[model samples]
Target chain A: MIYFDKVTKTYLDNLKALDEVTLSIEPKEMVTIVGHSGAGKSTLIKMLLAEDEPTTGSVYFESVDIHSLKRSLLTQYRRRIGIIFQDFRLLPHKTAYENVAFAMEAAGRSDEEIESDVPYALELVDLREKIWNFPSELSGGERQRVAIARAIVNQPDVLVADEPTGNLDPMNTYDVVQILKKIHDLGTTVILTTHNKGVVDSIDKRVVTMEKGKIIKDVKHGKLTL
Target chain B: MMTSMKRILRAGFLAFWRNSVVSVASVFVMTVTLSVIGSIIFTQVTLQTTLAQISDKVDVNVYFVTTAREEDILAVKTALEGLPEVAATEYVTKDKVYQDFRTRHENDSLTLQALDELEENPLGAILNVRAKETSQYASIAQFLETSDLLKKNETPIIDKVNYQQNRAAIDKLAAIIASSEKIGLFVTAILVVMSILITFNTIRLAIFTSKDEITVMRLVGASSAFSRGPFIVQGIMAGLSSAVIALAIFYPLTYWLAPFTTDFFSGLNLFSYYVDNFPQFFLMIMGSGIALGSISSVLAVRKYLKV
Candidate 1:
């Protein structure tokens, strides 16, 4: 369970990135955030990741304030959530398999766990055939899938995807969306942000739309009504 | 814990190999630094040996009058030898001095005839005194000039003390040795500091290229030490490799310079010194390389790990 109660983030020049935004999602629920550029979608995710602090109010995970944790505690806290980016952010020198195993290794997992789970995670994203291919050798779809495998390899409680399909072709975007659906069905809480109308309509899950820095609409099992 | 450590080490080695160009650059800079340090050691040794040879060539001689009794001369010699600054004293008897005089004139008939016409030997007995340090020669000479044994019975038996004539040369040599040591130390310190700075900047550039990887690692929940471990290990490997390269370079370098150093430094051979003190040199170069590499990596990686 994750909660953001009345969070507000203000940048220099008094620009409000998030304005008293209150939102919550239960465990095993998938939520889609739809907004144009500069709609506070990434800022909200950043707050949840503790990458940025709110100017007012606190973000919490299961009743624990995320920003209040110390350095070591913050690392442990972050390990509970998996994050994917539009860039895929895979280490260029590592193969797809190594990239996935890197997450498990960071979480102090043993070699036996990595050896068994890494292949299984990559297989979930249908990237088993390109296991040893470096990021440069992999296609954009395959790289995003590798990023997906890396995110889920450690079995985080929450998966956060910020514009993961922003750079993908239509076919690749569809594939990434289907994979997100499969992951949500497997009972992991998913928070995804995207501007693609088709992605929002296809997901048909709880949709939250934002304008400027405020959430203007919240619909359960909604279509892209923006 | 062991698993994490193994992962860190593996990642380090993998990154080092994957980024070969950067790794090579770092190693090259470290090698240059180690070489500079090694050169300083050799230079200091050569300088010390040359200064010692020059100091050994200087001493003061006391000439005794022919009328001086042998017992009085012996007593004076014993007294001069008692001083702490006196390293050694050689007594030349009157007869030996006469023999040396005759040998010198043996090449000229006129001088030999003049020497042979004398009833007894005209040359006096002599006492040669050497001091432990060139600077202490002045004090030793002063001690002899003020001692009561030379002016006994209201008449001086000592003909001349050669210290006054050699004082200027001795003082100049002492000054040269002191100033050369100071200059050597100053230059060495500057070189060492410059080398460390250059090495640090080189390692920093290598880390800068991996700044993205560091951010990705931190975002993926890697601890500070976990992320920093690989860079530190890479630095250590670079340091170790450079140290070996520098040591290997010193072997042939010293060998090539041995003849020149021996000729210029009065039998002080650089190659022999290097071979004899290989262990000491190895420790110094290896220790400095490893320390510089690891410390630079730690500091450079810190800025990127803040995310």
Candidate 2:
């Protein structure tokens, strides 16, 4: 239930990061956005996450227009959508369980709820055994899993995996892909962007390819045919 | 709101513990600020005590001529006593002055021989006058100067009339002390402002280091209000710690240091002064701590919580 209609994003330096791009995602669908570097893939998700605004057209998450939301209410809207970064931006000071619980805490979940749901979220990401380990103590695959746990901790309607497995080795990448597929199967809208051809082809989901600032192709039940 | 407040407070405490370097540094800055303020408070207390002591010893004694009639002089003393400033007055006859002087030196034979050789008593009759306080001296002196009954009557056989010889110097010193108080308060206020700025900048750096956590808080749904609480708490803790520390450091320092200041202020009872005003000093220390802590926290949190 997310839509972007004729969206154009211009950075402060007049960089036309995205231009006249129109796209929509229905409920419970997994869409993969594929592009090379500086291809506006990140800008697309950044707009949806309410981190950046469209320069010309509107971006909508469900019924609310993101561009005009006041600063106070913006966080309320953003916490509904989970995003995992390329760096696996888990708080280094926090343990795996605490990282997931941090999400619930940010959402103002009660102590009892955080205590219950954080462990459950970690278990889902197969990080139950690494719950007490800090990010530095964990392997790259495990840290990514911790990030996934934080992303899904609040049971967000949509998950944007912007190069979620970018830092992982092949085996860990495969593991992360399986986690995304499992999350998608459980009925969360999953949006992934990557130039990793192997992971993209293996997913066999709907794929959208971008070049410059425009959406070049959209294929359902498709390969990573960029 | 209640739930959020609890979260903020808990988070603030956790953050303070986790960010030890920043916390300790902030606390140290707060200590320095409070200590500076503490010294101001100490000076105010001791100065008041010294003023009170000066006032106790100060009296305006108007001396009359040796040739003045006892009756006329007594009448002048009565008139002087009528003035509102006069606390007490006594008539000192020249014979009594001579007699007391002879009794003291009579035991010393050489001084006794010199005293016997002098046929006439050189001492004038003294009007020993005590005023309400040294501050009342000017008004009392004004009254005596205007009293022709004491001043203009050659018939009264009056000669050079004078009060205490050292009143002028004492009065001048009192004026200097009063002016210095105003200047002291002004200087202390300036120092306070500088210290607060120092404290604010220090705390700001600590908050700046946690920029990533701040961004993460926003992404995870923490309100701008919630994110600010920890830094504010950190500032308050610094202030509070500074308050306690300054008192702990200053109390003993005052004890050892009071005696050293004897060179500048002879016979100053600084040790007793601190003992008497300890309550007031404690309050000042606490107030400085809270001010530095809360204001610095506000500055830091306000800047970073713009999300």
Candidate 3:
């Protein structure tokens, strides 16, 4: 579960990156945040990941105040959550399996656990056969799948994706959306941010629309509209 | 603890082997630094032995009174042996001294003729006294001059005391050895600093070259500690490899170069000594190289690896 209690983020010179906003989402829910460029959608995800802090409000995940978490505990907090980026961010030198196994290793999983879970996660992402391939040797969609395999490899409770399909073609976009749906069905809360109206219309899930740092609409079974 | 250490060490070693150029550079820097240090040690050892040989050549000579009987001078020689500072005392008779003079000047016919025409044995019966150190020479001379029967029993009075003859050369040799030690220390310090800087920059460039890889590792969920381990490992590897290389190069080098060094200064058989104590020399070269390499890498990574 995720909660934002009137959270506000102000940048240098009083530029409002995210205005006072409040929202909550339950576990196993799929929520899509949509807005044009310069809206607070990306800021919302950044705050959730603890990459940035709120200026005037507190954000909590599962009754635990995330901002109050000590610096040393940040790694533990991140281990239970997965973040997917538009860039893929796959290590170019690493094979797909190594990239995924690296996530488990970061969490300090035992070697046996890593060896067991990494392949399973890659299989879930339909990248098992391509696990041995490096990022430079993989296609765009496959690289994103490697990123997904790494994200879910640890079975993180919360999955936050920031415009993951922005660079993918339509077919690949459809495949990634399906993966998101599958992950959501398996009981992980999913938060996706995008400027794509078509993705919102297609998802038919809880949609939160932001405009100029404030959430203007929150709709269940939501449709995309300006 | 062992398991954890093994894990960390293996990771460190793996990280070192992962990057080629920077690791090689680190090894090279470490090798050069250790070699300079090793050579200084070798030179110091060589100087110490040479100084010992030179000191051995410096001994006190006492000429007895011409009127003193041979039995009385023999008594003086026996008395000299009782002193702790005197290592050895040899009695050179007048005839032997004359023969030594003629043999020494054999190359010059003029000096040989001068020694041949001397009527009496011009060289007196001399008591050659060697001390443990040059500093004890004055004390030995004073002791002999103050000794009882032999002190005033000389027939024509004492001819000459040769203890102070080579005093200046002995002092100069000692001063040169002391200054050489100071210079060696200063040169070693400078070389260590220079080598550390070179190794630090080389490792930094290695990290810079792989900056993108580090960034990617972080994005995927690597803790700063985990992400930083490999670079440190690379540094340690470079250090260890360089140490091995320096040892490999220096072992035979110490042997081959030892003889050449004796050409410049006699009584120093550096090559023979190291060849005889080969194990110790190997450890010295390799140990220093590895230590320097590992330390430099740890410092460099500590600065750059802070996320």
Identify the superior model by TM-score, candidate 1 or candidate 3: 1
**Candidate 2: deviation at residue A189, Å?**
1.8
The candidate with the higher TM-score, 1 or 2, is 1
lDDT tens digits by residue: candidate 3, B1-307: 3433454566566556644555676677677776777676776677666767777877778886555567777888888888888899999877787788778888999977876686776666888998876667778888766777555533444666765686677667657756766886787688767766776676666667767666555545567767676666666567667767776776678677876777866846676776777688678766665565556556655554433
Task: In angstroms, give how far residue B145 of model 1 lies from its true place.
Answer: 3.9
Runs in model 3 deviating more than 4 A are A3-25, A33-59, A65-72, A207-226, B1-18, B21-171, B210-225, B251-259, B267-278, B303-307
- Cα lDDT tens digits for candidate 2, A156-195: 8999999987888999999999999999999999999998
Model 2 spans > 4 angstroms off:
B43-175, B261-279
Please identify model 1 stretches exceeding 4 Å from their true place: A12-14, B62-133, B146-160
Quote model 1's TM-score.
0.90
Whole-model Cα lDDT of every candidate shown, in order: 0.93, 0.80, 0.77
lDDT of 3 by residue, A115-189 (tens): 899999999988889888878889889988888888998898989899999989988888999999899999998
In every candidate, how many clashes are there? 0, 0, 6
Which prediction has more favorable lDDT, 2 or 3? 2
Q: What TM-score, to 2 decimals, does candidate 2 have?
A: 0.80
Instruction: Return the top candidate by DockQ.
Output: 1
Identify the CAPRI category of the predicted complex in candidate 2.
acceptable
